[model samples]
Target chain A: MAKQKEEKLHKIRKVTPGSVINYTLITLIALICLYPFLNVVAYSFSGYNAVLSNKVTFFPIDFTVSAYKEILGKASIWLSMRTTIIVTLVGTALSLTLTTVAAYVLSRPNLPGKRIMSTFMLFTMYVTGGMIPTFLVVKGVGLYDSLASLFLPVAVSVYNFIVMRTFIMGLPFDLEEAAKIDGASEMQILIKIIIPLSLPIIATIGLFYAVNYWNDYFNALIYIITPEKFTLQLRLRNLLFAGELNSAGANAEGIGTQVMTQSLKMATVVVSTVPILLVYPWLQKYFVKGVMAGSVKG
Target chain B: MKQTDDKNKAALRRTTWKQIRKCKWLYIMMIPVLAYFVVFRYAPIGGIVIAFKNYNVFKGIWASPWCGFATFQKIFANKNFWNAVRNTLTLNLLNLAVSFPITIIISLMLNEVLHLRFKKVTQSILYLPHFISWVVVAGIATNLFTQQGGTINNILNAMGHDSVPFLSDNGWWIFTYIICNVWKEVGWGTIIYLAALTGVDETLYEAAYLDGATKFQRLIYITLPSIKPVIVTMLILSISSMMSIGLDAPLLLGNSKVQDVSNVISTYTYQLGIQQAQYSESTAIGLFQSAINIIILLAADRIAKAMGEHGII
Candidate 1:
């Protein structure tokens, strides 16, 4: 009993001087990752004079929401937000459906041509036809200038498919076999037995697709010309790079002039990132699992 | 002999058909995905022919007049193309140099933490930036790094130092770029290493502890060796795609003054193909890049296998 207690005490580890330094460095690194964001929030909420004077750092000085009020009051921001939400929802649905069906179909043990199909899919991962060719094809197929151009052309990520396949293939063989023996078709088996158990992976992959669609500015930048149809990221890019924020601020309820462009820009950024921040904590654990599964590389 | 071969072919065909028939529903389900691959992935491969032709919007891929190596010749001679290639190499190398070692080290640090709550909170904060869009990141970056009334520069000025120009200056721009990338991806990169670290046997550490080994010694003796395969694999993967870089960071972070330093192949291709409408030349550049990528990947795979490491291929 004494020996076991000693072993347990030893297992708990001693708080050495080295460990104190280690914890300090680790905490410092985490703080470095966080401070820039804290600065942004500080800027977004700070009064115009405080931000212009460069006093906002860790927290809002002279806290005010005029920037947010000016930004939220704008129609352009709302339109782009709606556009992005639609694209995210529709794109996630399409990508999830296609990827789930593909992963399920390809995961079957005795499925004919499974190897060939998998090799076909994997081949695309190594060799892509380059951006110009992809653009040509997307435009040639009449998907240009449409919101579908953002997602349909790149709906099924092979990485997500492989990860989903690994998850499905890891399912208990007996459960699936028992279902098959009970006269369930492959479709029925997938719907009744597989999907219910595979919901975690499905949610992980769906979040991946949704995040991809949300962050996809390049596609919208290349494909869509109409400002009305612009995704939020695209609109945000325009607001940043278009250098129109000067005029944009001038017309925004007259507080635009009172609000610094820096605050306005940061406020827009904070709003656009809120959805991701909201969803991330809830789904953070799943992301680790998703990435680990992906790193297995099928 | 011919009759026997024919009979064997028929039998093989019949069995293949029987197997396929048994899984017809699976095949039916695969039709859309197969169609997607054919149209989006494979069909563009056929479009690579435009690299050798004078690509015209009205002429189309099939009707474009063949120009042989002329477009490739033009791309090869362009100083801008060479500059872009050099810039891409510089940025990618610098990025990997900072991110690679830091990722491994941070993984070790996280592994050493005894408090689960503290580790979890730190990790979640670190990973939060990965989910933020580049547009948002750039916005945040500008607010922090800009010279005129920017937060960092303002702090420097307050400290009685010269304010650094992070955006307009090429050297400083590259520094800013690396900082942004490292800040955003360092936490996420720890995931793969942490996963590898978890797979290391616990008893080795316990045994080492009983032998009076320090934590540092345990990490060096046991943890490092255990995660060496993953480390080797990551190095091979990163080295293989050294020629390719993303378009977002360079394009968004770049401006007119720093174009000399920031115009990588991807952004160059975007400019030439979409902005300038020099389709054939841009397509040739893409082909050249893809060719370089394949060659590098294959060579890396060969070197890895020859060195007795598990090759990424």
Candidate 2:
């Protein structure tokens, strides 16, 4: 087995010109992908006056930590950040649990009412009842203006469920058979065998759910009335639309309109994005692989 | 034999009950999801009746008196409604025309590169813009295209040229919106195409190479045909979402100066429903948008089937 593994490694090391070109292109594309993010980071740290003067570009010209300090000093920013973190964590947990069970049940090849249920799920994807109806539904359920409103309404993503079902379906049946032969129940088989092997896809889906919850402003914009319940994205939108930089201790009069707003906008963008961006690199390989895997089956 | 048959039937029933009992954990697991969709998806669907009712706050949806087709009639009579429809269709079509081909080309270019690390880097860079929210992108765009001391104006002034109001101009609004959207989304869009490209048989590419087919020719014959199914599937998907041009971009970028061109069904509905509290009329318009989207999706799916492609049915 060791010799065979070594031989496989040796074969993989046989590089071709095509492979070299592929590496180069991917690297260049990755840099291009990272550039705008880098530009935002640069602009966010650059002095407000310097950034407004258009002195900052790919790199910060007059780097200052004041913008960071200014934003951090705000009590509301921290509150919103805490709210977003709570929402994202709770939402992802709920989404994952429900999505997994529902997907697993739906994925059972001979499960009763499988076709009917699948069609029902698919119907929701294609034909939603629209915003007002959905809002009414939320209100009807007594989830209005609550944290439960944020997580409960968006618990099952049909797309993620589909991806998960596809992944679960692709798992080897031999393992389940072995568990059954050992007198283990179907539930035990899933818990002990299927879940352990399904971690990559589960994690990938969880990340996707987390990002969705984190980036979600529309729900907060519509459902949330209290300022205390605001997510990061909603707060950013409020800042941009309301132009309330004067309240943040920035001398709005001294700073040019474009520079202050743009820089502060950049700051908001950075703050809202950094947490997700930080988590992405760790899961990116799984994410890309999961996406490809999911697409292939579909 | 009769006794054995009776025993088997009893066992089957017992097993079914046993299975249900055994999977109680799974049922528990599904509760949150079930509750969520019930409240959000199923419940909101019930709210569709508001379109046909007066929908007074005190009376609420159930208690409100039905006013059949009045909201629809009002929506039809409103000039802004028609303008929004026209703008949405035009912008979506333009986005389809421009962004679709560019995504394919970029994917092809990325595929052609032999160096894995370089290709990965490029992909990462390209995908970065997708992560930035539309609100920030709109901010960047306005900064670049603003009339005074903006980047575009500064560049134009250097050439002794006049700077045009790109954002506010009706003719330019659609173009600007499309460009910014493509810039943000195109890289992410390439992901599906790239996955499809991987499925192309290696032998076909080798055969083409042996036949002295150039890279470009190989791409035309081997690569394009390989990913055609994905393209068709995505096109169908895009057509499904054609009416939903997303409220965020158009709302953020739009102002009173350029409302005519930038307004879409979603933003208009939000304006009526949320901002103005014209609940019944907005719901009617919302229903109209949903109907249009469904029609287009069904039509597109039919076209895909006619073209011998598997479509989302």
Candidate 3:
């Protein structure tokens, strides 16, 4: 008991004045970041009348789940959610394959015309043809209003490709040379050796692509005209915009609509954000490390 | 040695031919990326010709008759376009002047914190707002600042002051836009600086401490110099993107009263192209914006290289 008390006192003593100040500043900043999100949650949960009266701030004064119930009860929200999921999954898969394959090829020192190909790819980063021509091209290609429009147009990010290439370049060449000496084909070596070692970068880039695709509503807005093909973001945008038109004092039906709309908007934000946020903690260490590594080398 | 040289030449030619034969698979792999650029990026260059032509949907791109810069004439003739240009440049300049320094300062402070747990939590919290779309953020802002039942209004009413029309006021439009943008993006902007700060040598800080330097002095003399390359790189990048003052925030935040102050090149182009289908005029304006962006980027790159900083050459 005496030893335990002493150890606890030692731990307390280790907390210097600088550390105390640091912790306080960090806590304050964290609170500032967290407060607005909490306010949103509070407002979403608080009764409509309570929220209108500005009674809700950090916490709900009169709690209710009617907003959520109304939002979740709708079939359209579910459908949009389903579409967003499909787009995210499919888009990530396509992007990862294209980026990895291209990066692998470019990373090979023996690859012919590597420098020219790389330069050609990098040129696109700065000199895009602008929006009108792109829209016309999409029209020309018959991809307008199609789901492929979202995935295909942005199939590979040049930045991701560069990062992945840099990473693959940093890998020891001895392994590849060894595989070649053993008469292993290029495909076999890539499948067996290179892939296992490259998992961290692959995962990091995959998550980045996934998050980008999930957050993207721009493509859907520009390309998709049909209401049925709307992603969650576009759907949420429509709902939020719809709220603006009906912002006056709620009618009998309007109250339900407003509550439901507000709740669903918050819920949609949470839904779109949560999966990426959840994955972040798992992948964050690699992400930070990989990004720093990639940036510094580049 | 002569025989080996001849053999090597033969091998080189043989390998070149083999590569050509295998080019089909490589080309197939490149199709998606190439198609994307061709469709989205390269195709847009052709649309710039619409600026010269009196664009007609029926006549299509090729058949549209030349109007000899009538669209450019109209664009420059508009007083509203000049207002937009002025607004865009001023707002961007202000954003750079304020937010850039603040981002660096915040990053340095965050980096200086010794407690890992505290740093992680702060970073995570700070980054949260970045992920929430601007539309949602605008909604939140409106709710907070609304005259009737908003939190700000409630506080003002309690303090015996009349509520201000934050959203509707033309004077407040730029300020509102800047604040909302800063709120949403300050954390994200700090990322590169933080990454740069991590590279700062700990020994320098220790040396400053031994010389009896205070934290502020250490930051000024040691920390700032360590991250100078990163600062320059980011500054140049930001300068390059000056014309792309995003459309979403202003579109959501600006009401009819504030529209004159809030309208920018991008929003103007969207209006002209997508709304009015005045493709020629819009493409002209877009091309103009692109030209300016390219010039700025080249100039910035040149300046960086002149200063012995690495650039995206």
Candidate 4:
């Protein structure tokens, strides 16, 4: 048995010249992928002179927190941050609730009118009213120019609903059937049996929703009119493209212009992205599972 | 027998109605979702009718006068609309050409690695960029590709070469756009392919090894064929959606200097409808794009089925 095991291990670990090349190529590609992010972090922490001199690369030459301090000290940044937090939290909750309920009900294969209901949801995936008409609807519904417009207009993602429903439908039906025999109601069955068994998919769908809400700026850009209601991504776009770093700082005329350099811009980028980056490693395994499940589509 | 068939049909209809009535709680749960679809999805579709009318702000959507394809006529004549269509197709084709094969090749390479640890780390790093917003990506890109104190430019200057206008010159701007896009999405694209690759039976490779097949030969004979369905499916899906580009990437990566090349359908709709208040014209363009999209989708599905692959439709 030991000799057979050794032979199998040898077969698996055969040193191929091609594999050596593959490893080297993959490592280089991975470094290439990671360097841009590292460069952003390096520039954000590097001193102004180091940044101006183009000395910062993948590491900080002369580190300082002044850029972060200058950006984070402002009232507008906090206000926008607050607004973004509110939207992401409320949007994710609303989306998950709507999606969960819809998915659970739709997952039952024996449900009447299931075909029509699913077709109603799936048709939206292919064709939509386009942006302008959707904009008109938002306005017509009186959701225009409000924080609600940012998320309420897109409350239940058809893709997310399909994924969650697929997950639910794939579960063992015997448990639910037994519970039904024991006089458990559908709601009770869902809350007691389905939810506990569906933690992985629920977590995956929740993360997808949170990431969508967190990263979205277009909804905010179109529907949100007020300066105070700008989400983090919208505010970042304004600063990055329009160079609104002046409005983000308390004392603008002197220091804002002086500090409104590339370093400061990159610093703001890093700060806005930190929340997702912090949670990513923990959420990544679920993300891969979610993608794998969703990829098996009709 | 015919009379029994009629009786069965009647009984089935009654049972279906009874089942629906019995599942009152389920339907009650579905009300909010149905309402959401009605207000947002179905209503927007109905709102597409504004394309055939002169939409008035005060008169609202219903009171707007019917114009009977005049809005579409105006859109069809506009040079900007043609330019947008041209740019949209150009960028999408370029993206498909560059990123599609690269994703497959990367997935193949990752599959070949014996070192599981190395492969896992590489994949984790590669997938990171897909999660980052386009705003951050554009910001990082501006820092790296700008002609002034850009890092790449600094390297070029140090090598005694002139700095390139990555984001300014039209040709270079397209190159930059594709690079950023591929960098961001190429890794994430491999997930599906890798998943497909895993479904390939290991016995095929083992038998090929007994036949003294080289690694490359095994890949060609045993691996590629296994995932061909997935490849074909993805290709059809990508081709069908060729008319649409997301607003975020082009809008964020683009500046006024390259508006001639950057203006696509979504951005054009935004600029015209929201910024200039040409709601009718913009919606007309949108409806036109949607018509082409549906046609392409149906054609692609037909092609897929003809090729003996499952149609996405």
Fnat by candidate, in order: 0.66, 0.42, 0.38, 0.74
TM-score of each: 0.95, 0.88, 0.89, 0.95
Question: TM-score per model for chain B alone?
Answer: 0.96, 0.94, 0.92, 0.96
Docking class of 1: medium
Per-residue C-alpha lDDT of model 2 across residues B87-179, encoded as one tens digit per residue: 888788889999999899788887766557766767766766766666667666665566664556667777899977777677777777887
The number of residue pairs in model 2 that clash at the backbone is 47
Candidate 4, B1-313: lDDT as tens digits:
9999999999999999999888989999999999999999989999888999989988988898999988888888889999999999999999999999999999999988877788788999999898899999988998898787889998899999999988877899899999999999999999999999989998788778768897789989999999998999899989988999888888877776777888788889888998888988888888888889899989999989998888886
Off by over 4 Å in 4: A1-8, A243-259, B1-10
Worst 10 residues of 2 chain B by lDDT: B142-151
lDDT by residue (B96-147, candidate 1, tens digit) is 9999999999999899888899999999988878888888888788778878
lDDT tens digits by residue: candidate 3, B1-313: 9999999999999998788565545556666666666666667765678789988889888898999877899999999888878778878888888889888878877886766787787887777677676656776776666556666667788899998766667776677678777778888677778888877887677667657786679888998999998898889989998887787776667655666787878777766777667777778887788789999999999999998998866
For candidate 3 chain B, the 10 contiguous residues with the lowest summed lDDT are: B20-29
User: Per-model i-RMS in Å?
Assistant: 4.6, 5.5, 4.9, 4.8
Question: Which one wins on DockQ?
Answer: 4
DockQ values of all predictions:
0.51, 0.33, 0.34, 0.53
Q: What's the interface RMS deviation of candidate 3?
A: 4.9
Number of backbone collisions per candidate, in order? 0, 47, 2, 0
Candidate 4 residue lDDT tens string, A1-298: 6765565578778877777888999999999999999999999999989988888878987889999999999888899889988998999999999998898998886899888998999999888998988998898889988899988888999998888887888889999999999999989988999888878888888888888898999899889988989999998888877732212222211223333787888889998999988888888878777777788762
Pitting candidate 1 against candidate 2, the one with the higher DockQ is 1
